[model samples]
Target: MIAAPLREKKRYGWFDAALRALLEETDAALEAGVDVPEEPGGWWHQYVCPTHGTELRFDPREREATAFRCPHGCVLEGEAYRGAWLVFKHQERARTALSAAAMYAATGEAKYAEAANAILEAYASRYPRYPVHPDAQPWMLKGRAFHQALTEAIWATTILRAFLLLRDEGALQVDAAASDVFFAMVSSSMTEYRRILIEERDEPANNYTAWLNACLACYYAVRDDRDGMETLVSARGGLRHHLEIGVLPDQLEFEGSLYYHVFVLRAYFIAAEMAERLGFDATAWTGSAGQSFRGMLEALVGLAAPNGELPALHDGPYSRPPYAREIAEVFEIGYARYGDARFAPILREAYRRADGGCGGGTGSAERRGLEAVLYGEGDWPAAEPLREPSRLYASAGFAVLRHADNPLSLLADFGPHGGSHGHDDKLNVVLMHRNGFVLPERGMVPYGSELRRRWFARTPSHNAVSVGGRTQAPHTGVCLRFDAEARRSYAWLRSEGAYAGATLDRHLWVDRDVALDWFEVRLDLEETVDYWLHFAEPLNVGGGWTACTPDAAPGEDEAYGYVATSARWTAEEPFAAVAATCGGERVTASLLAVPGGELYRIASPGTSVDPSRPLDGLLYRARGRRATFVAAFAAGDAPIRLARGDEGSVLVAPAGGGGTAMRFRMTEHGLHRE
Candidate 1:
């Protein structure tokens, strides 16, 4: 029953492989004295399923006579179990094959060896060949197209491990016919994949499809096929383009959400592994796929809060957050490949941070919830999550603190740009550091017209200039042109004397600028000056939200609000309000209003209120009016300034006497004729 030995190694031995490594761990556990039933008539065992938490039974006694039964049918075997299939999938089969082989060699059990051969034979017979298509072809209805490619690659690599173990055990089953057929299938698949990818290599967005191409290279290299390796190496152009377009230092997703970023990084990491195995370094092609992997992990760490939850995005699962368990997996891979030990501490800290966190107690913890995984060890045994906090988002805020490299001087804006995964949020900045904690985008994940309005066109979702006091027309259920909300005519992140500048052009109507220097997060906004403003109104001598400020003690600047009013007039001018909502139930808001057919407006402070109104608390707007206002905040103790300066140095006080002044130029519309 011993499998045939196959392939030669370059620098690594068969024992160093992933499958072999896991097997070694299991073997060590067994040797540490977990009672194992002897071969042939070995006894079965029962335990709770690790994934579904259902009762499970497994018989290691019989090679082909093992049985497993669970009430949920979340057994380790069978096609009817999607949940089970996802858990102990093809990857597990590969690992199990090596483990069985190693156990057989150590115990000299015909049963273990037979078990190894059976698994190998079963996979070979089932897949036989890897598919070349990116997805299931139109006619291939029974199974997925990409599944065959990914699964077969797993089978081939693991079978190679099986053969290697068999050879070392001196139980070589060298069936020349079988070996040739397997090799031919792998080699032919590589050829087919390479040709298809090459023909469509011009398209950059189709980068994920290259994962199959990389796997194809691995299979070919295992067969010592050089031509196929060359083809695989040549197919990296499109992938490189995809990674670059995803993010830039200056222009980022408004909200610091990184859902799609994970998939892109994974694609590159898998390719790098393939490149390394084939005697080719992918650093040049990938421009440090390893570093990119590190960057992503670091970002995840930064994204984690003290309590271990990532910032809440529209759809959570598309991009998973990090904790000890995930960090361990990343570090293990990094340690194996790059020989970097720095990742060790990061992993250890992630575990420490996630061990004891508060949970929602809905017991939905294992539903692939990103928040659960962020602050706590989640369901993984190797983790130690932090103590759970009361609110998940607050916990998420704490989780992000764990990864803050520059907690004091850094800035993070919660702006989801381009509406990835149908989350329509832009210009919303969640700035951290010593100024104000500004939560740009308010709540309401799904309360709009269509899918487009729900995603890309909701007013509460964006932090940009609004006209007629409304969000731009909804995204028309399309990617490229979502009603052209914010054309982003020009945007640049520049280093000022002490801070940086974030400015944008929303066509001709608005010129929005955010200056981040020392001690303040200043926003200089110039709107069309024609629409109705709800919050701050009636242009005054100074930019002062007077009605809301005198009695309140500014605690922490976390969030803010902007609205236009048509119902009342403090000094005979329509107004818009900008209020800063802090963590300590103190809300400091200002009302700035522009009158009908007036270019200049007056500003007064809106009344400070309790934190009962969550930033997701309410949506208050005028019934019928057109206005634009912005809400920006930062972390730390710096002042949050919302000043309107003109061409001259005359600072007209909004409240007639004690308003702050801007040292720059200015312009004036009309006087406050109240």
Candidate 2:
């Protein structure tokens, strides 16, 4: 069993051809290369910003490498971008170590082996002296290997993988003392990494937590530490213990961020690959939803937009996040083990559609040179996922409704307003029409931008109800019912803790006609309740809710709320209803007022008078004990109409009325019609 890694390598000998090709491409000509990289010990060597003509240098000999400054005036404005640079620095070293190992295997070049050994030695000697980051969360973690244990884990996983390669292949030639020192450096730092994982054991496995576990599993396997490797098994109650519990039953990560989903899934695949090499048994694990390996991949397929990009739910990319790219190449290892035809084709197609032409962009920590070498050659068979859409993560309280023909997906959020990465979008509704948004979540913004607070975390961006004009409280969302049928299906979600005494329930029925999309939202408030309908850029607006439209800028500066002298819907003025057309779809929204008429407050089409402002959603509001809004939206040239029954049921009719209509029966308990 100890020789399992050798057997595994021998099994994949076809990959050696690819590795040799990459070696020649890089000219791994040991005949002429001798000088080590000038700066070899610390993070990055030196970087110059092309935009500002500024430079930031790192000296491996200096203890205060983090205290360096920007010369020629290129001060980075945000730390997220800065953090990416730091990760990149580690990535460069990892790529180097991997390249050297692969090159040595292909060419039997002594220089390649020596170069890889020198870098590892440098890391081993300097690894212990690095101080723990002061601002790391959880308070107990102290990263002596790097500024944060997360970064330290990345560094360890990288060099250690190379170490295993060299040691197993007989490329490593070192004295006994040198070997002992290298082993000691790794043992000490890895202990700190393990401590962080043990401390945060009970929390859900977010990206970093999952990463730490997977990396350590690989570490123990490489070191041949039997007791340590056992710590990762489910029987021992370890981090990788139970896949069923950590990943929600729907197979989506709890955070709901596509990038994080990719981050964590990548960690699992990498670890599983390493475990296989070292003769570990983790490759066969499966979760309740499906297996975390294949099941989660299908879940991601369901959550994706028609174009294959996922919505940036939490701390995901501002534009559609690219975590799916992480799946294709990393999934190669999993496909070999499962041989599930369903997974390979879906993964390959997604990889084919990648904007980068593969999984990662150049110069990203996600891109490993060896990954390119190990990926399959041109003989991949074409395949597609054997699954359909609108998967529900019941345990996490979320659901998505999708139709392959319509390319329109409705994502309903009722899950944990997850952690810090989560937005305050419990029971929020996001409608996806191909690449366009009917109602969108506050997409991410640069962390340091003004829009970050104004758009990312606030209530106005989400399609939610504000009771008494206050945002909902921090409550996990609940999905009461979800049925995905051709035309008769509907979605229902409830938010009990969004307010102190108020409860908001939303139900949406998707008519197969694509022109009779109807919904009814009920807000039970103790004091005042204002139901909001935030639409994307509207093509046309015809309604009674336009009276609150501001004529100028300061009037719509978010501070001033317009008070109409005479209300239109409830008014002394006249009675009218709200209607709109967006991206060729017509939407009509109306509230089920008990006996009185509906009162509303709507922003002007150019409310801010600045067409540049992203705040274009309309707000139709009312103050009462209980208010229910019945609305319908559809895609086509016809206007959708609604009629309410005396018994409190509502009927929605689309143009061309070809026996395709939807109804909603309002009741004291809840909705009875669909």
Candidate 3:
């Protein structure tokens, strides 16, 4: 039986030569991008210009140029060159070399072999001299060619693959010294990364830790460092710690970002796959928390929408369907390794996404080449995509309520707002109907931007409870209960730290029986607070009072946060409820009478919006303390009706037999469930 690349004899290693041949034919081989003219020709690179960490395409019409320029005529300025783009270029050179070597192997062509040897020799000669990127972090390995350890580790895996590809083709045989130097560079990189990773073994880990372990695993395999592999495999709180803290029990990425989750998963997947390829057992290695590598991928497949988009949560932007070409190679490879029949249908969906250029690679020959072999796209028949069930991520403190039949879904975030990438939106709620937002979460801006600091990440920008005219305080949440039983889904999250002296309990109840969904927020406060509900657009109507949604309201400043810019209750609310057209949807909300309860139409606080533009928002001021606000909203154009009871509770019924009449009462003592 043919051994994996790492186990093969280095002296005569054309590892996976058949795959290389396929890649060469399709220009997806490691050396596929390398160009050699049939006749000696002038440098083709003369027509191209590189700038701003991006490549500019020339018109190719101009024969001669003073300096290379893109069609936009922009001169390229070199930034610190330690990014993924630069790393991709380096890999391009390596792949090009490997492709040429593969051609020589197949056809015994001397020129191809020489071309391949030249690339390896050039890199090996200069390998020791390429300085650490000026922008590299202090902890980054000084002599490593890549700026980031993660990038360096990735380079190690790909470069080694390139080396193995050409070893059997007599290229490495012709120059034993260069071959030793090339592997020496690999050894140096592995040693540095392993040292740094082990040094910081106890730090609260992130995706970086997962990647570090992956790199170490791959390195151990290549170097035949069994002891090193054992050290890593047995390292306490190393990869195990990352899994324990970073991934929830149900396989949710604890950081709450789909992008980062995928990023971390891919690295671990590569490592585990590499380990198995080297005849090691790593897949079943669960973390300290009993979390296995397989569990992460198991739950990830359902996250994609019907069109293959991972739902945008945390830092990932809301992508429309076919989200960036969903890559299913992980699943594809998973199926191959585990021989699990379930992955076949999902694999088909992933292949469909790859065909759309989101995954598998449209322009990358290396990625496309491997994908063709690894994915086995057509080997599996297509099946219906799996729909993610309504789940409450209790450990991570995120609650999602998705309906059985409709696209109406609500994401309630009570989780740790994740460090750096986190928002101050504790107990915040985002609702979607038919994939269109009924209540939208604040759109994300660039990380660490001034606007992000001041507004976008603030609690006021979210659908949350504000107390004492300040944002919600930092807090951890306990999901008291989560049940998706028969007709409805019920979840209650209690947060004691939301306010310094108050306890906040938010309940999301979805009753599919009556086709109604609503939120019940009860704050046991020591001080008076305000409930801020920001809508996507201006409202057109208010029951028991006049609703204002002018093109531009006078005296009201535009705001991105829910903080009131300028708001006044025009007249005493002698009526029980208010109804209005909230942006694209309709909403009718009535307060359960409290001693100090008062309601008014307000505007969202944002620096970006013009004051002349209408900002649709709602504010309910709980006069004294201990305020309970009950709000019911239907996703689409469902109007509402409210009738106040004789005592204080308001009976809420939608225009068409509102599913359930939810009652919430607030007294000086506390909230009373009616």
Best by lDDT: 2
| TM-score result, candidate 1 | 0.46
User: What are the per-residue Cα lDDT tens digits for candidate 2 across 1-674?
Assistant: 11223223434544555455446533443322322222222222123333322234332222223343443445553343344345444555555665677667656777778877766766655544544555444543445444456656655676777787788778775444655565565556655555545454644353566666666766776667767666565433344553655577777776777656766777777666566665667646777456567777767666655434455566654331133345555555545555555455445434443334321232222212344344432233443333355677786566777655553457777888767777767777776665345665545543333444444455545666666655556678677777877655567777778777666777765544442223333444445554455655543444433253343212222312322212234433222334445445554443334344245444421111121333445454555677766555555545455666556666666545556545667564445556
Clashes of each: 101, 4, 17
Model 3, 1-674: lDDT tens digits are 11233222223232254355444543443223233211111212122223221123322122222343443456543332113224445545554565555556545567666766666666666566665546555765443566565655655555554454556443564355765666666666655655665465544456666666776666666566777666666664344556776687867677776666766776667666556656667666676666765676666544443323344455643321122223454665565456655555444444443443321123221223334343332234344434456777666667776556544556677877676667667788765444234455644433323454565566666777666656655567777777675566666766777667677777776654222323343445455566666654556543355544432222221223324444435544433444444224454444434446656566653222111223466666664545666666544445444445667666656446646665545444333335
lDDT: worst 10-residue window of model 3: 36-45
Pairwise lDDT winner, candidates 1 and 3: 3
lDDT of 1 by residue, 428-479 (tens): 2333222213332222221111222332234333333333323433222111
* Candidate number with the higher lDDT (1 or 2): 2
Better of 2 and 3 by lDDT: 2
Q: Report per-prediction Cα RMSD to one decimal.
A: 14.7, 7.8, 9.1
Q: What TM-score, computed on C-alpha atoms, does each candidate reach?
A: 0.46, 0.71, 0.67
Can you rank all candidates by TM-score, best first? Answer: 2, 3, 1
Which residue pairs clash in candidate 2? 234-241, 390-400, 414-477, 473-498
TM-score of 2: 0.71
